[model samples]
Target: MTTDEDELYDADEDPYALALRSGRGPVYLRLVDGRRIRMPVHRWHEQPTVADKTVLERCIGPVLDVGCGPGRMCRALLSRGVFALGVDIAPRAVALTTAQGGLALRRSVFDRLPAERGWKTVLLIDGNIGIGGDPQGLLRRCGGLIAPTGCLVVEVELHDVEERYNARFENLQGQSGPFFPWARLGRRALNSIAADLALSVTDQWSSGDRCFATLAHQGSSFDCPDAGRR
Candidate 1:
């Protein structure tokens, strides 16, 4: 299977590889617009926090964790007897997840994934909604990947901006990798993106600094968490 289509880092010396090998320090996303987003590489090895547990508790059925770096969420779900699988484009990420006793595959979300249209929950957390730099396209794919009654559980930015961006991997030392495509969607922007794909925000909630929303196809009403203002 192909690695993540948006992966632009060199295998020999990518930020992910360095982080995985050293097991510490910084990895950053350098946006083409001269912005940098920090990625917490160490958190993948840490236990699930309240935000993670909240998301896990909200999951309905068989779960697919996309862009599952190091598989912390997947491992947590499995501990609760929930069938969860993690997929990532980084081989090191896959290895780390598996090494930690979590089930994971080194594959892209755009590729042929297992259990098509059978998953009950598809997770796009940790800014993973930004993958491929096309929120609508990715959401469309996730819509097709889930069962008719399934829902998408997503974590979005806290702001109100929605835009596609060119990004790349970088480290604290100022070294950078090739530019790739990415996107970001906040709750308001997410609403617009979801509506375009005919998805309805069933529920929304927040925990600490993170925000999450659950979605299902329009007109298919399902009891979600406390409804947040649309």
Candidate 2:
């Protein structure tokens, strides 16, 4: 079977990696229908924003940041005296994180992660819920990675929509990378998936134009009582 990790091997020549190194974008996620979603590589490389702080404040110690592209969140957490580890399939991303004094590993979330089921919090920000084009499968894997008392902090679409598609990275200079499976889940879709996985949506909130949710094992309180509170 071709695992999710197998699909995400980073190449030195990938346009996304190049963009990360340059700290500039015009990088985009091009869908099969030729529609493009502009990726915020610049924002990712910059300091965490107000919306990002909302997510950051909810994170407890020993946080696992999935698809932690450039590691701004992890770095911010470290500054806050929180233990955070970033995991990414992209080598450049990991290197940047480490360079910024944040600890990171270049590995897929689907792979054998350290301290499985023991993380205090797991993050799926920057539209990473779309990884593998399989939200249910991804969440199921995250479920196993999180401790019983830990919660998943996810950023969902601002509107109600659910989609799965093949996508590739494209740069403004007309360069394109290989296609990969991806998915998008709105709040309702995420709630449905959590219910099916025996998880519950304990909280949902919005920051600016962004939306977020907290999911935990059924009937369990989060490790941090004030998580997601303003």
Candidate lDDT scores, in order, read 0.81, 0.87
lDDT of 1 at 213: 92
Residue pairs whose backbone atoms clash in candidate 2:
none
Per-residue lDDT of 1-230 in model 2, one digit per residue for the tens? 97433333355444456446453347888999989998778878889999998888888888999999889999999999999999988887887788779999989999999999999899999999998899999999999999989999999999999999999987777778788899998999999999999999988889899999989999876665344253
Q: Per model, how many backbone clashes are there?
A: 1, 0
Q: Tens digits of per-residue lDDT for model 1 on 65-142?
A: 998887899999899888999998877778778878899998889999999998889999988899889999999999
For each candidate, give its TM-score against the true structure: 0.88, 0.91
Consecutive 10-residue window with the lowest summed lDDT within model 2: 3-12
Clashing pairs in 1: 133-182
Error of 1 at 17 (Å): 4.3
